[model samples]
Target: MDLREKERKTVEILRALKKVNYPGYSRDIVSFGFLKKIEVYDDDRVFIDLEISTQKEEVIEQIKEKVQEEIGKIGWIKGLELSVREREIFRRQKIPIKGKTVAIYSTKGGVGKSSIATQLAYTFSVLGLKSSLLDLDVYGPSIPKMTGTQDSEPTSYDGQHIIPVEKEGVRIMSLGYMAKGDTPVIWRGPLVIKAFRTLIFSTHWPDTDVLVIDLPPGSGDIQLSLAQEVNIDGIVMVTTPQDIALEDVRRGISMYRKLEVPILGIVENMSWFTCDSCGKKHFIFGKGGGELLSKVYNMELLGQIPFDYELLELADRGKIYVLEKKNSEVAQAFLSIAKKIIDLLKISV
Candidate 1:
């Protein structure tokens, strides 16, 4: 084929590469403006350069592999060269908070990830650190409700910057305020990403020592977006002591590893239950799943939060258990985990 024909074929091949699992975004690398340069030589050698906005090795590799595979389909293409340069756009949208940001994530839902995130942020505040919580669970934001701010809405001082709602010493921002009562957020991946960006960049947060983000369950767009946009100091994984949950926890750990985000430790929620009458601890959801997983991953077992009805009720009622149930075991567990996180990150309170 002639050089012009080869170049056209190369463009077609590049345009065929689509990002997998990034829902609502159907644009391929070529159309997404990520294909910075593509050169087709007379000797059937092809050179392609990509300007990706993510440092995630998995994402970058996926794009590179897809490009190579497409070009390889054209048997006459003897050589293929691919180069990816990280040019993250969201990194430039500075979060004005002077604090370390940590994200709490889970691979599966209904494992108390939000509860842990809310309590951890409150715990840090209780320890005299100026801490804030950002609920990135756009679809099911429970932080505003859990922090007793569900009835309140965030205000804007200059009609552009939003002032986060403060509740129990923890400043909070959540999409819950935007949604009507019990109405589901029917947004696509791109809209979700846009909302998250607005939440991070437009909110006016106080000078905080730690900012805890409650990421939605699963390693999907929200997780990928945060890793690409911000410099997360560390991430905490939340799981239950059950094989079903642990399976997803393994996946969560793998995702973070691929993203090169530091895993501070694991917090085993609903690890066990203690009988009120017998004063004996029961292995409610099996035992030691978090500890075993932590050992396998070489991460610290931050703490195991036992199952308690009172704690559950408190969470449901938008109450900080660490403050209300000061002398309870669950409260202490949260405090210990907060201290470990602070020490691990070496943040000055």
Candidate 2:
């Protein structure tokens, strides 16, 4: 292929990358390439020399895979190489208390943990509070997509620490931001725990009224690591209004009590489904699971958000419901829920 044709192919490859990669902090990927001297060869092979400061080897490998996939479509070029420098020793400072950190945990997955966490962070920001979201869901991160801040990665400060991603008003970070593609993360428990520690302690979280952590589902290693290392202010357990789900909530609350973290309250997602025609509500998942759990555990029932398809759609598309349909019942419900959360946190209005 001619030089011009090769350049065209490179552009096509990069455009293809825009479609395939997970939508989380693309700017970081761009800046990383810019800083690392990413070069495209005339034959279609690309070369990259990156110097990431983190000690996590998985991160380096992810970057390599993403870049190669972005360039692999066009032609077969010879050379592809990456050289990463490790700098894991982060400086420790006194804990600053501009805000509190709240982690959301469930005994299992699909409990809408990310939705609640992202909304809480946005609501705190909307109320003129500086809030940051730290996503510890390394295996499956959804914070970036929920906040509509994908393709905007965090930057490094002082050649060591990474700056948190800012969207609307909330600053955020996630393992999704560092992931390369749809590849399943098959990390061992120890490595996963270590990555969670790095995400919590290494990044420079700005001053805020709160920092919400979207912890991985269940009382697993990641949960244990966060509960032990970070001085969290509380834990908010999410569940649906189903008996099986409530059983999970019981275990989750038990774990938090064992860790001695205060229970903020319970948020029952999919509490009911709103009818489009009659404007009535239907409890498709039965009822009273959240209330019964709260009563049994002696914890307050923070709120019950009905199952609104629009809300789910907005979340799936990475747009906040409050922005899309403020007049909708879902929006009002979440606004009220946000207020209740603020009250529980004892944060200033």
Candidate 3:
């Protein structure tokens, strides 16, 4: 490559590196990324070095992987120097919110609430914060259907505690997995509550950083019971760009407020649809619902995901868009929203 091209590539790599935002510490793990040196040996080969200090080699490896990814942007780059130094990472005894609970619900169904929750949990796992998704939508458990893994029962770690099923990195617990695929979960209110409690307290969720609960829609008894039982860090209300859905969102937000759970933010899904043929944007649901709701409720409008055919295709195949296409516009939007959620929770790895 010519000098001009090399300089441009270097700039692009640096810009990409700046976009990585991950927590630097865990309970007993002090992890951070530091630049050691960089040497350009030739027109296409570059040696990048990193200094990672942590008791866990896994932690250092994580930093190294991130560095390599940034450096690889300048194609033909070769060789990596990763130096790991073990040091004391202060240990603190605190409640395990490594497994922090977050519930995603809407006043109405089909607002893409489950998709947002699934993507959020997947993003957390990708960013090195272990997370899980609990499908508490007893009436309609779609997480298993979306993610495509099923019938995998939670194993008992001690023959007494159940371990959640893992997928792509995020642990998952669902009624869909427990019951036969075709069989509907026909249960009473008390039975639903019991199942949910077992899913939460009984499951041996690995030292996870977050647990995103996909709740059933509306001001239902199950939703209220979930809010009452768990110490939820917050609730993420989902809605489309229509007054029909936003009206219910207002009620959902109010329910969370009454239950004393904070409203993390709002996700406006299917806010707009773009035509592939004409390359024109269309407000299929009639715009302005998200903005109005945000204004009235006093919460940041986290994101507005346009309706994309590819996203649905990927979701149907158990593929997370963010992981499948990291640099795509949709993936970038999800990552941005994930960062916002982390900031809201004041969470650190």
Compared with the true structure, what per-residue lDDT tens digits does model 2 show for residues 187-251?
A: 97788977777787677875667888898788778877666566788788788888855446655
**Taking the tens digit of each residue's C-alpha lDDT, what string does model 3 give over 1-349?**
4456666755665555554433364422122344443334333455344444546777667655666666566555565433333443423223234557778878887888888888888888777888888888887788887887765677875876777788888888887877756766778878887887777777777587888889888888778877666578878878788875444565576566645578887888888887878988899988987787776566889888888777799888877776787776666677788888888887796
Q: In angstroms, what RMSD does candidate 3 have relative to the true structure? A: 18.5
* Overall lDDT per candidate, in order of appearance: 0.80, 0.71, 0.71
Model 3 alpha-carbon drift over 4 Å, by segment: 1-97, 245-247
lDDT head-to-head 1 vs 2, winner:
1
Q: Which parts of model 2 are misplaced by more than 4 Å?
A: 1-97, 245-247
Using alpha carbons, what is the TM-score of model 2?
0.70
The candidate 3 region of ten consecutive residues with least summed lDDT is: 87-96
Structural similarity to truth (TM-score) of each candidate: 0.74, 0.70, 0.69
Number of colliding residue pairs in each model: 0, 5, 3
lDDT winner: 1
Give the clashing pairs for model 2. Answer: 25-151, 25-152, 25-153, 26-151, 26-152
- State which candidate, 1 or 2, has the greater TM-score: 1
- RMSD (CA, Å), candidate 2 to true, equals 21.3
Clashes of 1: 0
Best by TM-score: 1
What tens-digit string does per-residue lDDT give for candidate 1 at 106-153? 888988999899888888988999999999999888887787889989
